[model samples]
Target: MALLVPPRSRTGGIVALVAHPDDESLIAGGTLALAARAGVPTGILTLTRGELGPIGDPRLATPATLGEVRERELAEAATHLGAGWARCLHHPDGELPWVDVETAAAEVAAVLAPLAPAALLTFAPDGLYWHPDHIAAREIALRAAALAGPGGPCVYEACWEPETACALVAAAAARGLPASLWGLEPEAFGSPTDGLPLTRVDVSEVIDRKLRALRAHRTQIDRGHLFATLPDDLGTAHLGVEQWHVAGGPGPDVLGALLGEAVRV
Candidate 1:
């Protein structure tokens, strides 16, 4: 029997390989939605089922079954994001960093090779918020890129621009929440301000779908969650834009073409 509701897809064009169930939606749902809208087939490859994540409702799942529950949620969330396919590996959540990246990369590359994706999307070095699983996801993606060699799909890292991150910090402070959050100092909250300019994706049109995708991860985001409570217009205003930077390129920019944004990768 399949461990998840859906088995790995035999084909794809644009794919987001990430650490957990919601990371794909939280980071690249809009992009995937846009790609699907543009007739480009989209997919997701989650490294883990996010067993360590929150149990939004007691009725939904228990700690022991969270992984199974999340695998199903990932499928639903991927459909909401308009992806052609969704799948996850059995890697232990929260212990991904302990896995040998070489073996992990081989697994990732094997799943990705036949798909011939235009772009490979994953976390940056900071892992977006420095989660160990997220960092490991990045390492895996980078190694997968290396395995594919010069002709490989470009790796685009989902990340926060320093200025935007600071603004978010300020927003939290304005809302009376701690400026420093997620175990990192306020100043260390995002990618370094310097380096290659980041690419901004205007996800306004598909923002609703993005919101829906977030909601589909029912076990992860609940009523009190910002995503769960967000009004469509407000969601647009707050989550309308997403950012990415090229980790390496010289491959295909199918995603960039769909977004009308150019990247060195």
Candidate 2:
């Protein structure tokens, strides 16, 4: 069955290939919202159902249940953000136990040929927070990109800028804030600070929507820590402006350069 709830599409289209349901919110929420607000078409390709998550209930994360629940939530989040289509490749959540790169890449390639997005979003090799599933998702996207051909879509990595990351660290240190939120490590604490460059995307328009989506994943973000200390506006203020490391492009700033526009936010 088709996973997405169709939306009213606009001129330009964007496709985001990610590892899980919450990933679109955590990583590219703002951008997805921006595309929707602009009336641009936006779609998401989540490679797995996130069934392997370390949640307390095993039954809740079952392949059948988790897949459908994830699909439901993803569709809702997309509608909330005005995104276009949402679909999953249905690959096993954890280690395939038997899948190879070429096979997975072929699955992704089939989707790309039809979507033909103006821009594509996915994880960097670092996998942002170092989730193994995320790393796999990145590889799939890269291989799919190659098969789809260079001219298919402008790929964007959902990543933090090294300079901005360092600044975030300074901000946390100067403020005497703990290096975690809800027991989750601080965004800048352990990530590579430099030597890895990135592109910046201004997602100010839908920052509020992103926050709402994040909250929707109550299972993950409810542990209560840094997020509680900062007001929603303040927290989202940081998320409003996003950054990415472009894997293949003229450079990190290719989006701004190619789009010929920059958001002041």
Best-performing candidate as measured by TM-score: 1
What C-alpha lDDT, on a 0 to 100 scale, does residue 125 get in candidate 2? 67
Which lDDT tens digits does candidate 1 get at residues 121-140?
89888887677899999999
Each candidate's TM vs. the true structure? 0.84, 0.78
Q: In terms of TM-score, how similar is model 1 to the real structure?
A: 0.84
- Show where candidate 1 strays beyond 4 Å: 1-12, 162-189, 249-254, 261-265
Q: List residue ranges in candidate 2 displaced over 4 A.
A: 5-12, 56-64, 96-98, 161-183, 187-190, 193-197, 223-230, 249-254, 257-260, 263-265
What's the lDDT for candidate 2? 0.65
Tell me the lDDT of candidate 1: 0.76
Cα error of candidate 2 at position 151, Å: 2.4
Worst 10 residues of 2 by lDDT: 222-231
User: What lDDT tens digits, residue by residue, belong to model 2 across residues 28-114?
Assistant: 888778767766678888887666553424544454466666666677677667777787777888774345878887887777676
